[model samples]
Target: MTDHTTTPPFDAADHLPDELIERIRARAARHDAENTFPHDDLDDLRSAGYLGILVPQDRGGAGLGVAEAAILQQRLAGASPATALAVNMHLVWTGVAKVLRDRGIDDLAFVQEGAAAGEVFAFGISEAGNDLVLFGSDTDAAPLPDGGYAFTGTKIFTSLSPAWTHLGLHGLDTSSPDGPRLVYAFVPRSAESEGTIEVRDDWDTLGMRATQSRTTVLSGAVAPADRVVRFVPPGPNPDPLVFGIFSVFEVLLASVYTGIARRALDVAVATAGARTSKKTGKTYAQDPDIRWHIADMALAYDALPPQIASLAADVDALADHGARWFSLLAGLKHRATATAKRVVDDAMLVAGGSSYFTRSELSRLYRDVLAGAFHPSDPESAHATLASAWLGPIES
Candidate 1:
């Protein structure tokens, strides 16, 4: 571990160094094939301080916002979606910590230390049964004899569990028996004294295989009262900006999907220019149909980023209006995710059968892009949220 403290500062927009890009590109296949975490590539991110991009500056982090983080994720995913997906959990949880700080959590020092040290973190929100609710989880916490309640339940798709140092556990508080109370606890990943935590190696998926999004079971996991953040009451309440900030996660996800599509288009265009067809002895690029397909790919690739950028700018500007801002945020996510899926599908068609080959980079991009639409802030859920907002309380 060489000292990265004194390294010359680099711009995030330089599109990641060639060495790092080569490293991620080289391991993309192995990580996907073995369904293993991309530790080596993440090491590269740690060394470059890319992992701390979203950490606050006061906490020794780069203090970049969603915009810069989105750019970084897109560039990384352009080369390796699995590696990008694996690291995204940390960024999201760090954002949550920031939000907590705004609510007076006062634990900025610890967060900064962890970010500076490149500590890994995971968001444990999704559950097997409550997947439709997006933010809902099956785990619950209750008041214990000493005040802190025991957290119990299983969480599905706990990404980056293998390398995480902090677990952002989301669960309902059973102590409030009248209604479910949402609570988020920042627990040490190593705190399972009884060894009740179990990670299932059952995440066999079509894309982003290196994410290591397996299941984790926790039985009577004791959590301290202080470790648990304040409970969120059930209802359409809170500062609307809270939900708006969450929508930024979807934008980051969409950026990655768009980057994958861009990469696929790049490969298709370059290949089409050189490879000659058998019948005409002419390059595929000269064929009228192939050229038209290439044009369509180029058009799509050029169009999506501006839309994402505009949406992000809108969210940033609406920092005051809570409900309206949240609605726009959800709408942006709905559009971006849907468009990303369409763009990648077009990329695959342009690349032809070669894109389907196991070794083809385009094949991996296609798979990962498709996987993007199924993430938590998915297009369908975003649309439903938007519709609910439009219809008022009656729709729910």
Candidate 2:
């Protein structure tokens, strides 16, 4: 419970006041029910300068580090998971830019400037069956005559699809003289990209509906030479761009789910205090069994935030974990998502059958929490990464 208001740089309370949070939370249900994106929420957040939290102060941003960003993200997620999740993509780019600038590599400085100017950046790395993640891409990156790259492929789960001003994506450049390479670039959503990008209105899902993370089809969408950020050999390698994306993405994602768990716990506590057990003529809060359930939920939920904070602090400090970074980050994400699921499940049970109703908060939380498993570091990928780190890769 660090008082973020007194922490320095910027105040979370000032940026996201209680009234603003309540307004965002108030609209979450309507957006979820209507399966629409939170345009109003986004407008409010933009006005608050939230989209630039990671940009440096000199760059007209809050100048917060990953640690503080994690805290603010948790607060936002507690109010509206969909809004927080959608905004995470924008934060990812700013965080990545911060990481690079801190490390003396200013490849993504434009990202910081763009964010500070209220330009939304969407992550466009995900492709169908592209298990290689950041190490590789299925999208085709053709070299243009002007040193730009024309990316032709489909990217799934493109968050902030409707309003993103710039789309950050990676693709495989097979014709490069240096052999196959992965080109990381950003395509601005402008008249130049009118016929090149197609956003499908196919974001209906089980939960987190306000995210509107839809499919993006890119047919020769161009990233001007100035916007092309990195050119690295495909396969696992030590590149700042890769590490920046992975680290910021994982920590922020863990923060979002951790927030969901916190909300579920709070709801359970309120429900338990209000609901009386007819069998014992006492409230569920007074029941030993119910107390234990809450204790378990708290125990599981309590461990996540500290873990995220510590790792995020290390990232901000540029502590080198070397090859261990991947395992540590993946493990953190895995634990957060898994623990959140358990906490939400326990909460539903504590809140009783009424929580099973379609419109119940717990019911929506249950569905929102499931999307955690399907994020970048799936349970399988996380376990494999951990196994490789602890047990070493299997003998080829």
Candidate 3:
């Protein structure tokens, strides 16, 4: 993860020190066991200015790009996947703002300023069954007299639910004179929005429990005119907002899962060296089959960081890939998640039956890795994108 040949000239250790990583790692199991959000971890990250890493340095942030952020996320995930995943939601907004600003689109400058000012932003894009993803929304965006819009819809998997100050969301504005438009906006989570935003405390899950990415009920939550960012058509387009979100989300998600694979490999290596075979009276590391398995894990893992770094660097450099961007990003996400799952499974086998226990770290990783498959650009959608890219769109 430390190798950053294709990334920016930044060091992950400076922002996420070894001590801080270990501290977060120590708290992960407890938070997981209790099914509680990692409040302390968030506090520590905020104090370290990790929340504003993507904001411009002049604006009081680390001023890093997606490449650097990807490296930092990998390090963080190596310690605590849930914390890294939850924090990804906040980073997504700042990353999007950065993406927009890099291309001279300053509409989201407020997002950068907000992040630099210690305001936590939560991603409120996910819905229960609106599979169109960035292309469509089930949420209703009612136009207001003062040039604002009121959003009413339930956003599922709203990460950082309890601590977010701003909720970045999108809704469909069918009332517009020019047909349905997807309105991307930000709403505050304060006393004024008491009845509008309801966060259901039902995030208890099989793993990654520290995230607490609960369901959010947006009952006419208002986004002031100044905060409303985009008004794109209700379908696929080359809008910077959509590209920024998809690119950043896919890269960061890949980084987290890659980190999980790295951790699993390390654990497997250690287990192989320490555990002795009852039949041969030798360490498992000496067995040819175990060596091959570890090697396979290493091979699968070694390819991820470079891909993540290259794509992220391309994004920061604003390289145009046309329609190919979706296919490339979708493939990266699919490979990262699938490879991480395989590595974790192999690691569990190497660690033997002891890893099956709930107390084992590999067991936790086993469950956490399963969640990677369920994220956006899921296996089905990813395959579709790739097929369309290589074989051309299916004939009507």
Clash numbers, per candidate: 0, 0, 0
lDDT of each: 0.69, 0.92, 0.92
Ranking of predictions according to lDDT: 2, 3, 1
Ranking by TM-score: 3, 2, 1
Pitting candidate 1 against candidate 3, the one with the higher lDDT is 3
lDDT of 2 by residue, 85-174 (tens): 999999999999999999999888888988989899999999999999899999999988888999999999998988999999999999
Any runs in candidate 2 off by more than 4 Å, and if so which? Answer: 1-10
TM-score against native, each model: 0.87, 0.97, 0.98
lDDT of 2 at 346: 99
lDDT of 3 by residue, 95-170 (tens): 9999999999989888888888889999999999989989999999998998889999999999999899999999
Q: Which TM-score value belongs to model 3? A: 0.98
Stretches off by above 4 angstroms in model 1 are 1-10, 13-15, 99-109, 131-135, 145-147, 177-179, 191-195, 239-245, 314-318, 391-396
Model 3 weakest lDDT span, ten residues long: 1-10
Q: How does candidate 2 score on lDDT?
A: 0.92
Q: Which portions of model 3 show Cα errors greater than 4 Å?
A: 1-8
